[model samples]
Target chain A: MESTADSRVPVLNGRRARNKHDKHQRIFEAASALFTGQGYSSVTTQMVAERADVGTGTLFRYASSKAELLLMVMNEQMRLTTRLGVAESTDAASPNDAIMALLQPQIHLSLAFPENTAVYQREILFGTEQGRYRTEALARISELEDAVGNILARFAQTHRIRKDIDLNGAARTVFSTLHMELIRVSLGRQDPQTLTATLASHIDVLLLGILDPE
Target chain B: MESTADSRVPVLNGRRARNKHDKHQRIFEAASALFTGQGYSSVTTQMVAERADVGTGTLFRYASSKAELLLMVMNEQMRLTTRLGVAESTDAASPNDAIMALLQPQIHLSLAFPENTAVYQREILFGTEQGRYRTEALARISELEDAVGNILARFAQTHRIRKDIDLNGAARTVFSTLHMELIRVSLGRQDPQTLTATLASHIDVLLLGILDPE
Candidate 1:
């Protein structure tokens, strides 16, 4: 009789876990669909919950805030882009080329959904240190920077990158430069192609240095 | 008869003008006090109006939104710092030094009011182009970028800077790098001094560059 009861409890627990996972997936898909190439300011969490067929309160369990909801969507993009970017970086022609390789896909990701990218970046840049999603977002950013650091370190070993510069510090600044340029895209000041070209030139300037060789 | 009617209208008009000016000043002062080093999300326009001793409805006439109110305060700060920064840049020893001189005060201005700066930047960075104040804010930013371009042009004329690079493009990229790093300060990852030092070093890296003397 105890064995029968225990077996019934595990079946109930399994169903609960599956239900929770399905709900999470629905919320995530809803956010991703709502956020894709849309003005983030216009997309309400209530709408996301409605789209997901979940109650608004239940949506809060998945993402505490709209910023977090965007994070939930963006963080996965971050992970995939970082993996793809790192892979591209490995076989590049030079240190500068490698760094560009690592960052190009990121640039594409950011530019693809300019609205969502701006909000996602705004949250990371200005959002306070709170909530689980922000922590995860920061972790993804950290992982990307570490990938940059590792790339720089590899180049430094081959004397392709300057050894005197701190690898991690340089990584942060390099990415900071890229991140800012990416944010500049949504300003409507420049066309995407012009902005991308200017950013490429800026990256080239960074590699070549602005000072004339003495 | 016409002179007497004109006299009455002028008296009323003068009082209206003075009332509007006084209320604007009050709202500005209230916002400055409320926003200084304070979490922007916590401060309400209602509180600002109350502190200014004006009705909340009246406050809307002065600033269309809280972001605009922050812009009103920060735009003044931006103008003052740019003037002082430009003066300092003229006496700097090198191109990099000149750029740093130009940006150092802007950095301090940003770091001094981390919360306000973040919001101000967020508005300018991501805010929709719909309001009068944001338009003014963008003009101020354009003026600042032009200043950077002017400085870069000066350095280029002396043959100290590379002539091949687009000064305006480089200036834009340079300031973008600084702005992003300034945003980084509010993340609670590093102290102000550490951040400043690292930023200075990053500027150095951008100047001296990463590739060995080619």
Candidate 2:
């Protein structure tokens, strides 16, 4: 076994890697379909495996359990949201605009898949399996938070915000405010359009606190 | 009922009211002990009924389910925190001091019952039974936020903050920040003392946004 790689099994290794990637993609698609169709709690791992056309063992190798699988889907969605949000924020003309651009994609994602969004929020905060995936999920969110912080730091450079402002803390505050707004929307306390508009106003108030006075 | 009143059953009615009050107290104590001892999910309605010496139907009459019971305990704890916080804040020398004083009791409560606090946070945010108790919890929390807003408004009267500052929004923002801080503590990401200190700093930043410039 130790001599296999030394004997030049690169082709075999490459094929195995491709197969693993394909299986992972199939499992993700299957899990997403099942979860969206029947909700997160009702869908079983066996069902996902059957739908993905993979062995149960193969599915387990991809994700430790159903909750981990759910987190995997969330991780992918968050990655996409962060990528799109950063791209959207690139053309922002001011700090508030940049903040809004960064958050708009996430709001759209939440609105587009309200059920999944609810599950994501619940799982992140309180799922029993949270300990297993908390680091991974937090890493993804930290990336988004850092993006917001970067935008604020850029504003500080331009003298829009106070030169001595704590960009990281301010960004966390902004992200937390948006988070509360999302919870309100998910709980049906507010509509999505209102959440978006209200978020803009909240950011304006946040900016008023952080930005240099006119 | 009117016929009974006309028949003059005043002594019987008084005894019945006292019995009902005692039963409510006993139920609250039993539910609190069992939830804390075995955790929320593991403790069943039957178990609570047995501990409280009440019928299952009676427990249902008190709280519709285990989740609701958890919320009931949380509701009581929050009421205590609010009352204590308000009392402490009455001696606050400034708006910032008042805000900190208001949040300190809550932080102490969270630290005292870390497990219960986690369950409370989760249930309030995402429990299925939340719909039943959301109005009640929101009403209680609104009173707290309103208290914070009123303090801010009082400060405005003294020119401590800008007169036109959105006190309600500012209060909400402040509350959200403390909420995030609490979540961090419940997740074991931050120590209680650090949370208290950091929250003070966050409130200072919040003040910067609303306070009149020097």
Candidate 3:
């Protein structure tokens, strides 16, 4: 009887895990639709719960507040964008091209939802310390930086990257430069194409120095 | 009689102008003290008005909200810092040295008041668009960028900066990079000396590129 009871535990645990995942997906979908439909400020948690078919308490359990929910959605979107961008850049001919390919998707995503992007930027830059989603956002950012670092590592193998270059530091600077460009784009100061060109120029300056090589 | 009336008008206008200047200074000093003593969020406009010895209405007239008041204090502080930094950098031996000299003072200022620096960074990057102080902040940033551009211009006259370089673009990039360094400092991720050194390295990469000259 003890052996039979122990064997049944896995089935129950698997069902519970699946239910939790389904509920999480439903909440994310509902929140995304509601947030994108009405502005983030106008939407309420109760409405999200109602649409998600979960108890308001369950929604709170998943996300402490509306801001956290927004961050969760953003994190998911960014992960998808990174996936697509990395896949697209696999065939990039050079390090600069790979860096651009990685960053271009993010710019396009920001352009697609400028309002959300602005809030995301503020949250990442200013809200990270106090927000519950800080860990998640930081993790995503580090992952993005790692992706850029990987490209540079690959480039370093074939080309002469500076001997004194700090790989992590260099990757971070590239990531930061891309972030600055996105901020410019979010501000309507640069369109996607203009940002791409400007970013390419900045990367050139980073790799080639502004002094004449001759 | 016409000459006497004209003389009286000038005297009245002079008194009014002097009063206005005095009140503005008092408010700035009061807000700065209060904010530095007890973080920004805890301090109120009412408290600021009382401390400054101005009416609450007058406080609002001078600064639309707490955010704007914080920005006003920051703008004043930054101007003073910039003046001192520029003065200190006057005899810098090279273009890079001058840029670092100009930036080091800012790092010192931020370290002196990390709390206020955090608020100022948020205000400048995320708060500018929505705040009443937007124009003032943008003008100040543009002025600083122009200062950097002027340095590059003077350097270019004697040195061989790449012909393809855009002086304004280069200046903006340098300004943006400094902004990034400060944000890291504000986050407690970097110390003043480390930030200064990293900024110098970043500037070297910007000016000389990461590739070998030989």
Top DockQ model: 1
True contacts kept of each: 0.65, 0.52, 0.48
Provide per-model DockQ scores. 0.51, 0.50, 0.44
**Candidate 2 off by > 4 Å:** A1-23, A37-50, A53-62, A127-134, A160-165, A211-214, B1-26, B37-50, B53-61, B128-135, B160-165, B211-214
Q: lDDT per residue, candidate 1, B1-214, as tens digits?
A: 8777866654545778899889989998998888884677889988999999999889988888889998988888888988898899888887668877877888888877877777787898888757788888888778778877776666556545553556677666666766676666755556767766776666665555433453
Chain A TM-score of prediction number 3: 0.79
Mind giving the per-residue lDDT tens digits that candidate 2 earns over B1-214? 8777776745645887798887878889998898878767778889889989999999888777777887777788888888999999999998889988987888888887777777777666666654565558767778888998998778777766665556787788777777777887876767777777666766766766776676
User: For residues A34-124, what per-residue lDDT tens digits would candidate 1 score against the true structure?
Assistant: 8884677888888999999999999988788889998888889888998898899889887767777887887888888887887788888
- Tell me the TM-score of model 1: 0.86
Tell me the tens digit of each residue's lDDT in model 3 across A38-132. 87768989999999999999998888777888888888888888888888889998778988898788878888876677778767776644566
Clashing pairs in 1: none
Clashing pairs in 2: A209-B209
